[model samples]
Target: MSGDYSIYTGQKRTFTIPDYVLFSLTLAISAGIGLFFAIKDRNNVTSKEYHLGGKNMNILPVAMSLLVTFLSALTLLGTPVEMYNYSTMFWWLCLAFVSAMVLASVVFTPFFYNLQVTSVFQYLELRFSKPVRLLASFIYILQTCTYMSFVLYAPSLALNAVTGFHLWGSVAAVGIVVTLYTALGGMKAVLWANTFQALVIMAGLMAVLIQGSIVTGGFQNAWDIAGNRSRIYFHDFSFDPTTRHSFWSVVIGGSFFWTSLYGINQAQVQKALSCPSVSKAQIAFFVSLPGLILIVSLCCMIGIVMYAFYADCHPMDFNNLITTSDQLLPFFVMDILGHVPGLPGVFVSSLFSGSLSTISSSLNALGAIIPRDIMKPYCCPNISDRSITILSKVIVFMFGGVAIGLAVLASQLGSVMQSSYSVYSVLNGPLFGLFILGMFFPWANAWGALGGALTSLAFMSWIGFGAFANKVSTAKLSPVFTHGCNWSVTTTAMTVTTTLRTTTSFTGSTEVTTIAAPSYPFIPMYKLSYLFYMPTAMAVLVIVGLFVSLITGCRDPKTMDPRLICPLFDRLFPCMPEMILRPLRCGVNHKGNIRNKVYEEADELPEKIQPIDANGVEVKPPHDTEAGVLKGGAINQGFEPIDAKTPGSEECITHL
Candidate 1:
């Protein structure tokens, strides 16, 4: 057999002419959007315009982009497999989605919108120091790179299962198309592409759900079978730190996870920032919530439908499914929708669309951050805007190349959803922590932020990697009971070696052994579910950061930029004794009592910084020459008030 012949011996259908045509059409539409915008707006292309979509993007497209970016192929494919293998506990994360959006809107959104920074890390520099900004930016870059590789890998693996397409070919095809459009059309192209792709994703998912339900008789029948088989457990109320996917973990820990992504990660934040106003951006966040919940719920239901269809004979038996659990979604689609001609293609296109939308957003965001954050400061300090724009496109191509290259070497890392989230929770916690400390704690200093971030990262690396290495074995929860379809199904147990023969097509193994050598001893903390990593690391960061700030001496609040602190904090704790507060207090009404005693001694004070006036214009500071320049240059460079009474404003460089 070229790869594995066992899985395809029966009536299973592969890709056909109509299927390929449909898939090609989907790709063409995406590229067409990019080409249309590239030619249409070529004349007015500027760094600000390209990177932020002229900072006037509508709320609907921005909302769709946010939803699609999070609902990538990782969620589309991996989620069903998660529900199939474990249970529906993952779906409850929708609750976390609500909390995350509320926090993002109430706490993080106003600050980012008000500050008007292209790279959100610029806020870190404004709040703490240059090193903190760079560290936070680098951490974000690392997280995206790692996540994008798997995002590209996932749907390709699915396509390979059904059509036998080479994994590397799928990777290159998707990567090149995403890069082409992202480089050519920029944020507008990305946003509109996401809007179209999001629709495709929903259509494909509904098609699968309806078809699978038909095959299983009805939705209620599928639910009954799934319930009987125990594939629908959602009430894990454990508070034990090690328990995976509990009520608290999914709700509380999930909030931090989603917040890190939506609140701090530049990819999602860039979409939100593209909107014309803070209220519009907040509207986008709110608009995304319903779609996010609906899509994930559908994915979870698909898992249940799969369980019902194979109730009598699970895919694990009889070369039953594709090589890995992730492949089951594709296999199920083929079984259910193969005879429908272009329908299978639609499903596959949706998978590809999911991958394309996410990778494109990451590429565009990476492009924006490079010249703005990394390259301009170190490589060419005085680089012109034209050079910077060119550099951004180059960085997109470079990172797209890296992600594709990594896709070739990538292998299945357990269930796709778990692997991606585990990686996210472990690495992104510190990045999120830096933002939290910056916005929430006025006393937090550079050493504290840096110290806490590094410590959390180190601890998570040890525990997270250790846990991945010493993989835990869980008992299969679902009892095998196929709905008695009598068309040559097998339920006999396969020996480990025989199972490996079929699995090697996707799992890339020829011989599997039941017992393997242990690489690392199990540790109690490492055994804790990956969901807890973010909240735990965040706690460590806050506790450690506050302690270090107190001991090391915090920056004076009056000397700190009021713009860098969260508006929620300003509104909530407007006053506290100066002895208890950090010595600096920049935004307080009592500035005259403390202003000159502090700001005059601050380093690199700007000659002048015009705070935003009631009319939304940058007016000259009430007092001149004493304001310290925020570490990063004026954050709201691209956004200037278009007209008086337009409610348009630039973020002021708050000088203490």
Candidate 2:
């Protein structure tokens, strides 16, 4: 009992004046950005300006914003823990980011940039039906709300270790401030604030690396010590699907995970569409690749460096200060830099920087989506522009409150990195598939898309959630005791402090191993690696979607608007054989393929659709639910009548 008490004492390090000042500065700057934008666009703020920075944002800041938004506090706190506990093999995920970004640049960016829509899910309604769009949007809102809670909770776990601040207090502080900024400045403030926060994230990481190296001799010493303990490793070339960190899993599964986020997710797509043109959006998308790789590499390096610093005497085993991998980085920061006034605060600020950037973007994107996809189309189709803008701000505040409430309920989970990725892979997989079906398979009707999504969701929920619940254990690293570090093991009130740490042969250790009876077995599918969730979900959705479309009498591919299909599909239809492409397009004459002229050229804008009432007075369609394409009156049985001037209708189809 006394030995464990000593461990708690070591962890009770408090922050000084300089530490508080540095942390306060980061929050103040974030709030100030919101104030600047609010004052600048006070009277003229419209839905476009609030949601997309009036579609005139610069390419560089927008790129940085996208990078930081996805790579949140989860990466900063959770990633290093991944390295320390397992091996450095997770570094290969940076390659996954590269592949995902390349795909986004070639395919999704051009489509969204040209569409001129506020929400990315609006593409769902345009391609499929209203229920599909609403389903996708609702999934996004639920996943992001759950994800933001984790983002807020991850950093707070670290904050509590060093500052003695209550965990709930930290969660509330981060969540409330992020909510305020997103509601006040809207999109512009979120973008600019993310740019500044990105720099802070880099600086906080660099400070730890530089100071850690200096305190522990040099980089060479840290590298050699960490390597001696098998910490620096990256050559796992296994093909087994159930293996957690194999090369195939990280490259293929990781790429799919990233693609789901960047390619189809509104949080990222919203920023990509804010640029002036498709070309600029593509440029911004590419720029984020290098920055992402740099930060992830720094995080990986920090993990190895941490192992070197306390290789021989891990605090968890000795001080009992941290039980899970998530707390390891915080333990190291407070232990090493606690004496150096503001340095610990800087590291904490980095965590907040990540959380603030992610939560702000998430809230703003949620605000945009709730109105554009759900409220505008169904509840208030004729809502004025000013009212829509006001409603967006209200949604931001409402969702932000929900995230805080969820964060308060969070407790210790398994590895933070895996916990986050597991949740992402489960929800994002089917959503990404819905977009692919719409773009690549024109014969796919609304019913097929909806059925595919619902089917994938049910299967993944059972397998993914079950696999997650069973794994309550975390992996431990081999300990390597650093010089000058000392710990004492006590039995019956006997204590001896020394620099030597050995797993075996401690006097009166009182440690005993226990073995429990095996529990019920998981089927092979449930036993598969969490990384496979995205690819599996996507495959199920596409396969089921295609089968359903065929059996239910799919629409003719020839009638599909060329704008709805990919440029590659439209141009190569003549050369490609019938068997290679789906049988849905078999009836269409290859020579009669009408190439979408808009995608063929680097045009400035997409063809706009304007609806009019019977009196010839121009009117905007009520909600996306009313504007979607319907088939045989199947799902739209009792819905309101759609305007003929809508884009998916016959009259506007030729113009599209």
Candidate 3:
């Protein structure tokens, strides 16, 4: 212990050998998984296999990977604090997960899967232009990299505060282990490691919940105490956009936010595309939803248990036990599970597992994006497959180093760390809007996308940063009591004096002076809840995009390829007349190909009948046409034969 414990609990606790061993095993197994895959697939060195598991990955592992990729250390450490401080209204975010999954599975997956592209940004290029693709790719790279750095740093900081673990050492250990496995084993390693880590994450959360419940006299008692304290709120159906965690804000705004993440973000799109078939990819997303809800519920309940344990004595108010809310969970773990030997280690391992799964997924995603989006298309078009494979692994290590360095720098950025969430929130809406514009509106050209994205970025940044600067907080914390604290004599005297001085000024009249409430500049837009940022930005982007497109001579929907457009009307209103749905789909063909557009112009047909096998190896087709097209649905099914010469090509048919 750091000798600071005597001020409060008069007990010093630290990690034991069992704890360290458990934590070490988590890291070792993750790296070991990478090594096993690296050695097993040594002979086959291809970019597709390395980045996408040759698009033949099993649904279960990929589903687990998707679940864990976005569920980072931030969610593990911060969400419990959110629940303890505010209300369980955040639980409504589960509905957002369901909505996002529905949109991703029904709207986004079919479009991307039909294209058979490496990166999701490729859709931007096919739908609009290369510049649009590059812009979106660059934004994604910046956002993910910065977010990953914070993800690596936050847990280490919390762990350092609770345990005596060196913060920088934790950062290095996680960064190195994730980089090693991701670079060596590639996507296969990432998926399996994520699956294992997901289990560890749940186990750790369960340990905390079970132990905390026992300490608080069981779950029902804890719930009753929390409910009595008004922390179990769920039906906040306020119509005001500024009301944070209200049913509308969380469900509606959260829907757009999560849809942005799952629908268009490269990390998620890459994982979804790893499956061999469109239905498999959709199934993976649906399967992940239950896990998402389970994790969120566990985190929420842990907060309630935390509140029940410290119902009378708030940790921060009692001798400043913790300097930040993020440190609360770890401190509570040490307080309750300190003597439990390996439990602390298991919890810490769970924290590290969250970071490892996230960073590994991001590293693998960056590895795929950099090579496919930037390097191959622009930097070196003639780059061979073997060379691209080598380059991708190298890029993973390089970006891993960059992330680690940024994480070290993040230690000095105290308040900026808090503001980073706002920054991420603002960007999600605009990015999702750009993709929506491309997919839904056939008239939206490249200029419109660029203009809309840039405008939304500016508009959201103004709101996000302005709100941060104004110290505008929408989530009002419930009252906490410190009357039950066993304060030291000296500290008690100092606190009494400080409290009296704030409420009364020393004047000759001996009259109590009323202190004026701090004035917050009332900016209406700035007061909008963070949850609304995504939907608001999306609206701005779509309106601006449509305006710009109309002014700049919009594309004729009839001439555009139907594969690039989402068949929204056909899917939703199947009973509607074809003539009505055709216009609603912006002239997209019902059979999934436009009659007026040649297939060759939209997507290049392969010159040989080569398709990837279950093992991710290339295999020759049994029958090949004179035009070198495979007769059957050899390319993972749902695709029709292409007629290069004719405009009525039955290519890229959707089974979705």
Candidate 4:
């Protein structure tokens, strides 16, 4: 019995020919999508088509693209580990997703869509100054690069654990494949590929959940077993900020984190801007919510099933079964499903798909931002469209290489979900704050925005790096048992013997070591939960920004562009009295000033407001004002200009 158990434990599954074929087919499909698009759009090598899909994408594909862009292999692999090791409190992030998407649609989406800018950071230049835009662009580049490294590293780590693939080789292969597709097909290819990958991810997750539950005797049995083992946790209402996944942290803190991604992150915002109109973009955002929730729930439930499956024979308790929690899911897949041909391939492909979608999106965004925000604006304004296209492809390839290199360094980090979130919060928090300051507070000057962002960046970096260096462990892992194992393994007797030997060697005494140990002093801020990082950083930026704005002499709201502001107060509370709304607007004249001016000007003109063409040449207005000609002669039938005094007028028309 002992020999058989040892043999069983030692033997690991390898990918069979069928598994390899299926995995290859996945890669081939992704590449083929890019190739098709590359050939189809070969003649139209303009920046607009390459970067924004010609601003003609449909709602469903764009919605799916947005969903997968942020999901990543980190979510697929790390989220399950999180649920298995900790509590289910993190599942409440579904609520955060809801609130974050709504806020993005109402606030950030309109601003980006109306501005007609190639890069989201260009809004900073228009709102503040060139220096502020440059600063933001650099921060976004750093943030996305860091995040891409984690995404690329996650699947590679899991693959190595299960399939015995060389870690760096897997990283290099995935990174190169994503780069080639992204460079070849651009935004169109990325979005379409994302749509396909999203289906694979869902199918893979469902397969795992269904199969695991069946193996565990059913989901109800799994649930009961998990509850018995104290794994079914959801009602942690603790207010302590240090509690890693309390109700407050997962919902409130997670809201800010998701908002930073969905609302303001370039990779996400770029997808929203691909739509022809703001309404379609908003629809896409809402459409993505259900799928997002499904994916997260699937990952969480998979964690529960895994815990139940290993309730007795804990994999980690066995000697060297796995080195990290992140490896647990892939190991479970191979141990359970490897015998079934193509099932392992499906799971592995899903992991790769998640990483490919995320990395490709980041690379595409980098390609767009380098030329649109930095190169064309400052370095070479007169560069031709063809040269810009070439430059963008080169930028994508270079950044992909950088991400592959950084992935090797990511191996040194702790839990993928926690470490990635910590790094993201440090940068994204400040970036989101800068956008909020500009959109909501019209009085905020460039100096204030710049000061606030820099201060927040420095402060968060200190806390983040300090916590990482001190190795402050916040996770409270659930207990595991090895008593059920039939094989000879490290047991209580071995542990006691090892402890006695260490004690004798250290203290020159044979007394047993006590359970109570000396506690080392730690910084309170350093021990702050990773969930609160974004909120803390945002608060710092806003407080410092307001203070600095007051000292630097606030920019007059009257002089500010109404198109840049979100009109959040008016949109949310339409019936609020002007007296209260004025201050809450942070000095933004959302409705009365901008709308009144446009109407006043229109009434004074004899032949209606003559619309300007795309080339800035004045053009004759269409025969009637019913279609509402925009400032640049783009006719949007959606917004018909109403009387300035009319109640609940479309104030957003001023943006057009």
Each model's lDDT: 0.73, 0.74, 0.75, 0.78
- C-alpha lDDT of residue 63 in model 1: 93
Q: Write the per-residue lDDT of candidate 1 for residues 326-445, one digit (tens) a residue.
A: 888888888778878888889999998888889999999999887767777677777876777778888988999989887754565767777888887788988888888877776777
TM-score of 1: 0.84
Q: TM-scores of the models, in the given order?
A: 0.84, 0.85, 0.85, 0.85
Model 1 segments more than 4 A misplaced: 1-9, 479-522, 569-656
Best by lDDT: 4
Report the Cα lDDT for candidate 2: 0.74
What lDDT tens digits, residue by residue, belong to model 3 across residues 519-632? 456678888877888899899999999888777556556544455678886655669996677567655444534321231133332222233333333446454542222321
Per-residue CA lDDT of model 2 for 1-656, tens digit only, reads: 22122232332467789999999999999999998999999998688788878778999899999889988889998788777767787889988998899888777777666556678777677677667888999999888987888898989888877677788998888888899988999999999999999999999999988877776667677776656566667786988886667788889999998887888888788888777777888899899889999999999888877776666566666545467668888878876677789998899999899999999999998998898788977899888878989999999999989999987545555666677777777888898889888877767777678789999998999887787667523233344333434545455443434442222222322222223423436466666677888999999999898777776557555544444556544333546765665454443333312222233333232323233222323344444334334422111212344455543332222222
In model 2, the runs with Cα more than 4 Å from the true position are: 1-12, 472-485, 488-520, 568-656
> Whose lDDT is higher: candidate 3's or candidate 4's?
4
Candidate 2 C-alpha error for residue 350, in Å: 0.7
